[model samples]
Target: MPDILAVLNGVSPAWFLIVAGLLAWGAPWSPVRKALMLIGPCFALLAWFATHETGVYGVIDLGPFQLETFRFDSLSRIWVLVFILIAFINGVYALHERNRMTDGAALIYAGAAVGAVLSGDLLTLFFFWELTALASAPLIFAAGAPMAHRAGLRYLAIQVLSGVLLLAGAAVWASQTGSWGCDAIGVDSAAGVMLLLAFGVKAGFPLLHMWLPDAYPKATGVGSVVLSAFTTKLAVYALARGFAGEGALIAIGLVMAVFPIVFALVSNDLRQTLAYALINQLGFMVVGVGLGNELALNGAAANAFVGVIYMALMFMTLGAVLHRTGTVKATELGGLFKSMPVTGVCAIIGALSVAGVPLFSGFVAKTLILSGAHYAHNDLAYAILVYASAGVMELSVLKVVYCAFFGEARHHQVREAPQTMLLGMALAAFLCVYLGVDYRALYELLPFGIDDYEPYKLNNVFGQVQLLLGGAFVFALAVGFKLFPLKSDHTILDADWFYRRLGDGAARWGKAMGELLVHAINTALTAGVARLRARLFNLFNPAGALSREFPSGLMALWTAIMLAAVLLVSYFSPMS
Candidate 1:
């Protein structure tokens, strides 16, 4: 019964979280278990604030290598802090549930992410990077459905591949430079390319994003909520850390922004729609990282901070609906406001926040990115981003609200979410509005800053409001005319079609080709053996020259003559 915390080092708080996760299995008493679950992040935050300066906190030497476990800097400070906050919020939201596997995995996954952002070196980062994958896939499988199992396998494969690439990149980088520090790397190098892809896969970069939408919806309700919070944001932090200032990310970011809107618009499942919505938000951050100025980087950081909170709120609301109604299908959901009135209102706030309405967190955060794009005179990005903003409002906010909560009462018998869920959603919703109005709180915490950039600019607010209103008007028109994509159980194809559909076809074709090649080789060998047998028969059989009896008799006479000729030739040749 001695103090358990005495054993913890002051290196990084992630270790405490990891240990707490391990101990969750033995936590039998309900109150003690809940206390243990909440204490990890509380201690982590205490540890975070205890460090007064930005420097490497823990260093270890192993053979010829140095592992820097904790590095607090301007870049990592905000990310680590936000991760800790999200962990605490997720813990609170999950307190009512008693699934050990999901709870343990969530803690470990969060710890791994915490470790990753705080890692001072690529080696340390890679260790936690892989751990994030190992720890989180269980959350998906915890859903206990066949589809969840399959999606989990796919998720594991892709995530492990990312880890492999990370390890390779780290090794190559370390070999070439004699350093394993995590810093900005240009994609021109082999190490950089591998690392970019590794981060890209996690960040939901266009074609690499299907695993997220595919797997997240299949996870258990709470599992989906927790999964949505951590993994992708960790990747975004990596990009901000390592690939900032890489121009290619600008184009990559736009694609990330605009493409997912299409899928989200067409998606039938509320969770799936949110999955795509998450990608769309990541797109903005990716662009900010690509822009790489103080304003842009700040925008990216701020966007990430706000995005995590608002997105989690959205997921929480939807999770509540799923928990109560047993479905999140837009086709099946309607007039949920009748029963789950508080949940619906909270969800609407989350939607408005995500849509970047004035007086919401997303408005303040997303405006920074748009301002960066405009200031840089990257008109292409600027335009795409503006369009995407409107589109985001259309799909994520308007569409989600209409299909899930509004319209006639299809589901009339469900109750509002439990008090714990409502409490979690309320806390997050409060922040969404709080951060928006008093933007300085978040703006001051940005990794970097701009003196002149303002989220509350008259022109910025006016522009965003007009764009959203116009889009809403158009959406209303579209709905009136049945122009919007109708909801159905069917899903539209994306890059995953290559692997999901064409990949299977290619596999079948390759198998057939392999069979044909083996058969052809066997046929040729058999034919050659037969041909050889025929040739041998022709040469040595009774009809052949060596087996002819007349040849022997004639040969004897010829041999005598030949022997005489040989003897004469030998004598004449001077060797008798």
Candidate 2:
């Protein structure tokens, strides 16, 4: 058994899933495809667990260049485990669907993300990084919506741009150092900045984040669930790996943490709102990355791990609603708890976890970030994050829960989510509670091993309670004052305003101006040509001076005189 396990340690968990994904495309039966979905993640998890210690376990040679394929260090250990776990849960959530393309795409996408996390060199990372983009785009296409197709194209473009930047950064770094290793790249050089931008796009950095809301909600129900698991988190992992302790990330992360709550508070689309909330959660992780102490890095990793489970849960619930009711619009949803009791319960649990209520995964993970900020002496940042979590994030979660499941009934009668979906949600919800109770298990997996950390001191617990109570008070006040706009059919305008509305308008205006300029130039050219033609006609026509016939005698006399003059001039010339 030990020998078999040792051999397993050398192989990447990613290949099993990638191969399974390719096989899924050729699978003839639905049951087999579903089993394949479960098989890949299960086997991947097994392979991940088989590793007893960390090192560069797998290397590939390409002529003169050696590629480090599997760097199973402490940083990648937790990331790989969570990715495999989510991939399995995602598989279970999707068992009711019958789309082979989605099955193949989701598995390949998950594997590609894992491969990127395990990569020890820039060249290896670049290969898997771009593979993730190519593999996941198909999930958006699987939605079959025209909007989805357009969004998928945009998503692909941004991801390809990220890849281009990564490749360029790698080339520059290699030129400078004669190596392509992935470690401790500070943002002090061009290559480092380029690499930062590459990671930022996928991490949902503030201005670069429109893709999250624009694309995820537009994908199919199962597609949305799968989409939530990998991309942004992968970027977070990259940042943690390459640029930990980067000071600029502090400011960038602060902005990411705050602004999305406003949009989430007003948006009608449940999944879209959750997408905003996703960015909000990522902000906390970013702040942790920026802080970059042992505590801070652990916070970032734990948040990412817990985040996948709860976010996947919330997405699954809304997806179930969309599945049965065909709309996640707040105005169109209500009284769903009566029928979809399991899903509604799951949503509320997810909402609590997201709100960082005590004894949940979020509370445990989020406190680490708060503590990180506090310990760093960043008083302002700590205050703002706490305020965002208590006031804004809590309020947004309320709106999601109230509007989607318990508010005044507007329309739709629906059954509970399918059995597989419930099981997936239940599994995630269980983790949420389990991780909160046993956070030490999570800490043990972090890059820096934990030592006597206390998350549940009396002061911290009471402070959290006070915030929860205060947030509840604010929610009541908003409802009583009629200030909360919890229901609408409009999607929140975000960076898409610049990318879509303004960009489309600009393109059209440019095109129209271009055509007008071309037309005016052509008209001027035509007029000038016509005038030139008329002038030529007047000057050289048969009735004109040059065209008139001359007398032969006069012409011959002129020719003879010219010849005599030319001969006299040539005789007087020195060298003629």
Candidate 3:
């Protein structure tokens, strides 16, 4: 009974979301929605503080099957806490949404996400992994546009594919190992590759990243916030659990970090640029996991934790711009600092955090990953990562802040964001500062020990500053030299090109082939039946004769013969 009570206590945080989803569904546009939004996170915070480092494991026995385990360790707690916090802030931010369906979907999405991180067994993790997809699809649909509907379908398809892969890998591992434990699998096996592919798809690893730009811009402000927090990070967590240190991930991570910078450089849409940037940032975490050292693992986990904040901050800032100025296109927006000072400042803070500027959350978190890479003695990987870091400063953090908020005013008399939105952004911004300054606490929560990490080392600080300054100088030089490429009217080809254009093309071709087959079959059947009828008619009626006259003559001759035979028979039968 006491054990049951403890489990209930540990899971209490999840119930808040359950309650919020129910209220959002049943209640109308009232304070109840707002209350549920605020109350949900408050309960999560309370639960996080109350739950201790007990290292307790809950097990359920199943005959002939592996026992189901639900355990709380230091490593899982960090992610769980972050998931809870993000869910709350996202809920508050989404309060401006008029659609109850969006609110409800966001809550369920949050719940499933939190559940995924807290899960202890592979089977449990798989269940939450799929639930997240089911819950988040509605948010994409809530955009209330035809494009959004199509994008939602595509997004759902990809997410389902990822889930299917995860389940298949889990099933294979269970059958081979006779355990459903969520531990690292050997990279030599098919199950490991399947798991990697599953995580890769979700992590937006290189070519698999199409759904991000396709779906994020189509989501509502609140929807974007929810979307940013769950899918990729969950995939990262799964990788950390199942395929950390796999050699293939190193190459995959490098591709992820480098390719997106080029797209972000040339792209005009601010939101899409950010989406590309998100993939770039995820590469750092992937590299850390591939390194497979303690510091590297810690770095990966820390990156996941901090990535949530910065990603949310970026999304919120962009979402605010879309809400106030009515668009997020770089060509359409300029100089919003005149009126929306709060939003402008918040956006800059977000930019700094993402850029890894000193004393921001990103600086502390990203350095750990880079340092881990160095510690692992993968100098080539480290060098590539350094270049990518400079690219991050150039493409996104600086470009977005300067172009969108610091230039000439494009709109006059624009108002600030709503109070709830501002509050949410402020809270996230505050956490960014808090995490940056008190990184020691964050460090301690990492999955691996990092005795050698010194965030304020002279070489580290100098290199980061040099990179940031160099990136800025390059940007200025490009502008001064008139080397900045003109924004093209055409869409840059990306991984989604194959799926969207090629997939659509394939569908059209299939339809055409099907139509041709149907036509050909119908023609052949008609011809065959016509030929058969003609042959039958010819056989019955004869081709040349219109009428037959021999039938009456033959009938008369036969009757005469029959009469002669009857007479002969009567004469012969006289004796009778």
Candidate 4:
């Protein structure tokens, strides 16, 4: 057999899991199938660990171009590690389920995302890009509900459109630049514009963002956890790779970061709330990419890294609630801290991390971006990022913890999640604290190695604490004023309303108006035809004009006079 390390060096870790995922459907026994799910990621992690240096690894020479499968560099290293970590955690989380489709689709979706991250060229990236879209759709579809079915179809359409845009942009780029490499192609060219749009579609750029919040919450509980980690982050990876430092992204990112607060405030479903907050969290990272300094890039990478864990931790906790309680809607849930104390604690930790409270993972990661914005002298953007960091994410994500676990006991008899699920949340929760407190581990994995950026400085910690307190106060004020939606049954129409309801409504209205117009026109035409028929019958029917005919001689004389008159009229006519 070939050397293990050598094999790892040459193969992308994704193949190990992708192959295993394909084989999972054929595994005759449940035990062996589940084992494959766990083992696949472990071996992929081993492959990730085995690589010692950064360069292209698996280069395929297909007739016209070379496909670089594993570009294990600093930037990709962080994303790949986090993805592999999530895959393993998700596998542990999903161990209780026996659905082969979810099992296979989740693994393949994850592996495809990893493969896309490690892709060195546009050609290779596009191939894996489409794969992720295809693989992840079934996870949403597996929810076995009409809503999930519709959401899954929309999700697939949007994702496939992103892939098409990517391929088109890459083709245009190759024509202009004569290479398929995915280095920093800025927004000055047409191809760059297309590529930014493609990535933006996935990155949750405002208006292009409906696909995320629409589908993720509607997916199966385990599916939501898996869906949360990969697709959007992959878009961030693409943006960092291609459109870093584009000034326009700063404005776009802020819009993305800020707008979700309103929707989250009114949302009823905890999972759906988290889905909106996902867009909010990603905006900060997008800003980091736009700022595009080493510090900003590192911040983006760090945020993306920890964002995965904390966000998944939050999703995992909510998923657990969904698992036991059958609903993530706030109106139908309350006060579960008694029975689900462990999950409640985990939820609180996840909330703290999301809120960027001091000594949590979010604080450590967000500091880099805030500092990056400050050092870059982007005061306005810095202020916005700071406010969004403190204000939006805290209120949005923390509500899940409060309403579901600590509010009021609407679900008293609900038991704890399965063992495997708790273990998943446990692993994710531990990382939230560990990465926050010991941020150097996360910093070291950044695209830029950890520099003099100390997150634990007196002012940094104090400021974040102050911000956290202020945000808490606002949340409390909102609650006091009855502005916070702790237990709502409302279906808040977000940007998604335009497509899901508004667009559908418009089409229906148009069809009704067209039918009305046609009916009116048909009525007028029928009336006119009836009037003409009656006039003709009155004038020339047998008992009308013909019954009053004169004698033949008088008729002949009249005819001769009429013929002379006709001849005179014809002679006078211009045409004659």
Candidate 5:
């Protein structure tokens, strides 16, 4: 095969989206919509393949800033290709959803993600970053429930704040450094810190993570699947691009790895549980980024690529459950294997992938990250990651699988997921297994080479199996003794308490103070008006002295007395 340079040298992948968006707009509920949804990715993929070399495609000089819209380097290629692949898979999954709002949002959201990854400058990245936020928020609100509305608002606030921070950081960095390139920016300067924070918010770092679980579970089924595919992964890609070697990320990653397990253990909603589990998995990638070596960076990239697939798989499976049974709560969902076998099997595959079982994509990808930690002699991070890996099995694999599919029947029978959803799940499932068995393809696409790392070695497989099976056995015992957390509808208090509770309290206090201020102003105005009215009545009434015949003489005497008093005061004044 000839290299991409020999065939089509300078092509812009973003323009293909215009065709897709136009096609989607032409028909609201026609067969053309489905065709556009599927074919759009194909056009993008063709564009992506046509460019084999790394070069800037769309460059515009804006006097003070040079905006490079398309940067086809190794780092961007890995991320953008997976994003396009995800868009196609998501399109397939959402094919059954005829809601034009969701369909349009998904396409726009996908385009924004592609635009962000391919951007070569901070200004361009900021533009696409905000577009992703603005485009994806509607997916959550499309559910049209009260909770969805509230969650969408919260999601919008956090995402927009991230964009604002990005713009601010970009301006500062450009002003200080006179460069707009999106390169590694360690948090040594104010601009770097601001950029780090901007990336941190979207990457769902420890304190900033509440929005993911809070909003994702509340979105419509198809909406949830679309939401799962893009935002956080894009953040991960940003981190890989900007802050890969910062030692601070190791501790951040460790905390990120372990912190969400508690919430996942106690979560009653399967979607919420999976959302927390997604955080746990992100921890590993963050750790990899912290390690800063080629192997570790490759590992982070590979994990992010595979993570998008598996997490979307899990969300898609449960989303199908929610669609068919009207609920995804563990208490309300059980023995679903008897009815929705296809979904159940797909969920199991997703579970295995997330739990990092051998021969699944998670195993291959997560190994590189952990191995990097171990090789770096960061024993603390290694230990935490190992423990967190087991915890992942407990919450995501055992709890999710048993609670939703393997237990006694608790509801009326329901049919299997639609053919379209199954088709989507099958594509993800094939990738999960294929990437595991043939991981070289994944590694080859990594930002770095993988010759030094071997995931399928006997020793690696043995250790992974030992930890995973041991965790499984312990989880089984815990379940037998009824030691696992019971189901409840109450929302768990998290870092969100800072916002949800304290913020709400502050808002209420401010509102009360505002009301009191308004009341005080009204009272003062009312009293002043009353006094003015009394004086007016006294002076203007028909009984006043001015109405009498001697009014002129009395008025002259009063004026003379006022003039004498003023003169007396002026005589006593020191300046006068």
Candidate 6:
């Protein structure tokens, strides 16, 4: 094992993914399949740790291209570690899956995300940026439905466009700075805007976030877990690296934190609502990153790390419900605790954690971000973030657990989730508790030292608890008064509409123009053919060629006379 570890230390992240892809392609039912699935991510984690002491990855220069990058910094380590853990957990969740395509796509997606974070150059980052698109597209298609297919296409288009923007930004930045390495390039130029837009699209920043909710709910159970971890976090990391303190991101972050709460409030599909909620959670981290202070950046990093765990925990609980009930529509689900007590309990823990209840993972992580907001002295932003936090509790953690599980078992015969699923949820639930109670390890892993960071301050803890309870009270009041807005039947418009409708519109317009051009060409061709035919007929059937004229000899003599007259006329005309 030591020798193997030594040998593995020399391999690149890309090579590890390639090997995983090959295994996924070749061995569909190998008994060692489960072990093989985790190898790539484990390798990535090892690679990340190998660079921890050095604080950066060794630079590899390809002639004029220099890659000044680090594999395991404080920021990158947390994310990469979460990515690995997500892969491992998702693999466990998906162990019973029979779809090789789904498994393959999941592995590639995980590996690509890990590679993206570990990239040392802008060119390398762009490579993995596009790889994420290629890997995740199949997960959407793996749903095996028409809606999934359409959603997959739209998702692919959005991701590809993001990749294009990233590449364009990399090109511009490389030209201007004469290097392709990943550094703290300021966001004061066109290149910076392009890069920001690219990350924004991936981060699901406000209107650009349509692809997330549109596609995530449609993915398979395991697919949703995988989707929850990588793409947006990568965008946050990029923003942390490239656009920190840009001021623009502060506004962008504000919009991100607030808008999704409204949509989540009105959404019917439980998973879709969670998707909206997910964006809101990301918004807090985005604001922290934009603040660009040590505490703020550390909060953003910590939020992202804990957010992945809690997000996965939430999704797993919901997914288990969907798996057992065959539906996740909150309107249709109620009273499931009798059959699924274990899952129900696990879900409640997840919900409380997300709600930032006093002693859960969310409490430890989210408070860091809220404190950072307070430190930044953006009272308006802080207030909105506070409101959004309560909104998350109201819509997701509280509503999902109370309405879906504990209310009333709408269907009495519903079986508890499979033991495997419960086991997975339990593991995640344990992490949520362990991390919350003992967060010293997590805090130390943050890039900046927070010697004075205290999450247990009375004002902070009581304030967050008050918000949660107040939100819960409001929910109760709304339910009691029948004032809660019922879930809408129609799909609310999202950023994906541009690609779905706008792309469709552009395609329709192009087809119309093509038909017009084809008709014009056909008409011109027909006219040309008609003129040629007429000319040929006139040449073949000249006048006075039928029997109405005279015999052949008479006709010949007349032709000779007409030729002589023509010659005489020409001679006279010239001579005169």
Best candidate according to lDDT: 4
| lDDT tens per residue, model 1, 1-576 | 123343333559788688887777567665665666789888887777776577887887887888888988888888888888887887887778778787778888888999999998999999999999999999999888898999899899889999999999989988888899998887988989999999999999989998988889888888887788888999999999899989999999999999888888888888988999999999999999999887888999998999989889989988888888888888888888878889889888888899999999999999889888987899999999988986554566677777778865684589889888888888889989999998988988887765556678787789788888888888888878888886567877877788778987999999999999977865654463556555655766765654433323344556787999998988789643
Candidate 1 regions off by >4 Å? 1-10, 26-31, 508-576
| Per-candidate total of colliding backbone pairs | 0, 0, 0, 1, 0, 4
Return the TM-score for candidate 4, rounded to 2 decimals.
0.87
What lDDT does model 6 reach?
0.78
Cα RMSD (Å) per model? 11.6, 10.5, 13.3, 11.3, 8.2, 10.6
Model 1, residue 203: distance off in Å is 0.9
Model 3 spans > 4 angstroms off: 1-8, 54-69, 486-490, 518-576
Displacement of the residue 108 alpha carbon in candidate 6, Å: 1.6
Query: What is the Å distance of residue 99 in model 3 from its true position?
Result: 2.0
Collision pairs in model 2: none
Q: Over the stretch 1-576, how does candidate 6's per-residue lDDT look in tens digits? A: 566556545344544654675588577674456666767667765665544253445466768676543455666767777777777777776666667787777788877887778776788788888988889988888887899898888889899999999999999998998877776777788998898899899999888999999989887777787788788888898888887777877788888888887777677777888888789888888898888888889888888888888888888888888787777777788889878889888888888888888778888888887788788898988888888886554565576676788654576578888877787788889888888888887798887898778898898787887888888888888767877665445577776677678978999999999999977865654463556545555665667364243234434555787999999988889543
lDDT of 5 by residue, 1-576 (tens): 356434445565655654585568567665777778888887788888888788898887898778898999888888888878888998898878877777777777888888898889999999989988988898999999998999999999999999999999988998899888899988988999999899999889999998999999999898888788788888888888889889999999999999898888888888998888888888888889989888788888898899999888988998889889988888888898999899889989988998888899999999988888888998998899999986554566577878888876887589999999999999998899999999989998998776666788898899889898888888888878888786566678888888888999999999999999977865654463556555655777677644343333334556887999999999888982
The candidate with the higher lDDT, 1 or 4, is 4
For model 5, give the 10-residue run with minimal summed lDDT. 546-555
Which scores greater on TM-score, model 5 or model 6? 5
Per-residue lDDT for 77-147 in model 3, tens only? 77777888888888777677678887777877777777776667777777878888888999989888998
* Model 6 lowest lDDT segment of ten: 546-555
How close is every model to the real structure, measured as TM-score? Answer: 0.87, 0.89, 0.87, 0.87, 0.89, 0.87
Instruction: Kindly report which residue stretches of model 4 are placed more than 4 angstroms away from their true locations once superposed.
Output: 1-3, 505-576
Which residue pairs show collisions in model 3? Answer: none
Candidate 1 to native Cα RMSD, angstroms: 11.6
Candidate closer to the true structure by TM-score (higher is better), 2 or 3: 2
How high is the CA lDDT of each candidate model?
A: 0.84, 0.87, 0.78, 0.88, 0.85, 0.78
